[model samples]
Target: MILVDSSVWIDYFKGVHNAQTEHLDALLDNPEEELAVADLVVFEVLRGFSSQRTKREAQTLLLTTQVVEIGGLDNALLATEHYRLLRQKGYTIASPIDVLLASYCITHGHDLLHRDADFDVMETLRGLRTWPH
Candidate 1:
């Protein structure tokens, strides 16, 4: 399964064209590819919208993908360890949510579809797999 991160989703929703969005578009076009959205990713994407109509539309679209819960004690612990590892390596992710989400993907063996640089850093240093692999 592929975990679609909020960074890609936000840009896709706003009609911003980019390589990641383009890849997401292609994946959406292919019925064979299994895509998932983390619950925290859903929250991150939805919280950015101000329009009720747009929010509802986004929610409806997001529901079409497999929704996966991104939290639990185990996930949190792994995320903490990953965060500490990164910090020790002199890299710091700005968002706790990103760290947690990356940990979820790493543990689940799901390739992440993201546009955030933090994920790239995680991929390089922490073995966080990403889409287009």
Candidate 2:
């Protein structure tokens, strides 16, 4: 399973051209690729849209894919551990949500699709798998 992060979803909805967005586009076209969005990602992406119509459009499209629940005490605990581990390795994750997202993917054994540099670091240091290798 590939969990699409808010970073890629935001850029995808805005039609921003980038490597990650392009990769997402390809994944959307492929029937074999299983893509899902975490609930936290949905919150992050939907709250950014100023227009109701645009938000509805994005919501409708996003809802077509499987929605993964990302909130739980277990996930939070794991996120804390991941944060502390990264900090001990001389890295500081900027967003609590990013740590949670990465930890969720790690524990669930799902690959992530993202445009954030922080996720890249998590991939390297914490074994967070990401799409496009």
Candidate 3:
């Protein structure tokens, strides 16, 4: 299973292509792969479609993917811990939502599919694995 980040979904909705986001769509097309989205990702994606029809389409598209919410004592603690560790490693502390999303993906042992470099720090410093191709 893979935890998809908002960036990829946004780019896909906008029909933009990048290395990682393109790979993410391709990965999801594979029958063997399963896709998941965090609450943050869902919120981000919903904003892209203002028309009810498009939004409903978006909702239906998303329903095809599993919803994965991550906000618990363990997730909170890991976010805090990961924040400190990332800070200590000289990386800028990102938004709490990013931390929360990353924490969720990491804790669940799901490979993240994202184009932004923000996650690379987590993948490098934390043991967060991402889609390679």
Highest lDDT against the true fold, candidate? 1
Per residue, candidate 3 scores C-alpha lDDT tens digits across 24-112 of 67776886888888877788788878799988877787778888887777899999999899999899755677788888888877888
Indicate the TM-score of model 2. 0.96
| Each prediction's TM-score versus the true structure | 0.97, 0.96, 0.88
Write candidate 2's Cα lDDT for 41-133 as tens digits.
Answer: 899999999999999999998997889887899999999999999999999999888898899999999999998999999999999999978
Better of 1 and 3 by lDDT: 1
The candidate 2 region of ten consecutive residues with least summed lDDT is 62-71
TM-score head-to-head 1 vs 3, winner:
1
**Per-prediction backbone clash count:** 0, 0, 0
**What residue runs in model 3 are displaced by over 4 Å at the alpha carbon?**
none
Preferred candidate (TM-score higher): 2 or 3: 2
Clashing residue pairs for model 1: none
Model 1: lDDT to the true structure: 0.95
lDDT of 3 at 125: 91
Pairs in steric clash, model 3: none
Which lDDT values do the candidates have, in the order given? Answer: 0.95, 0.92, 0.81
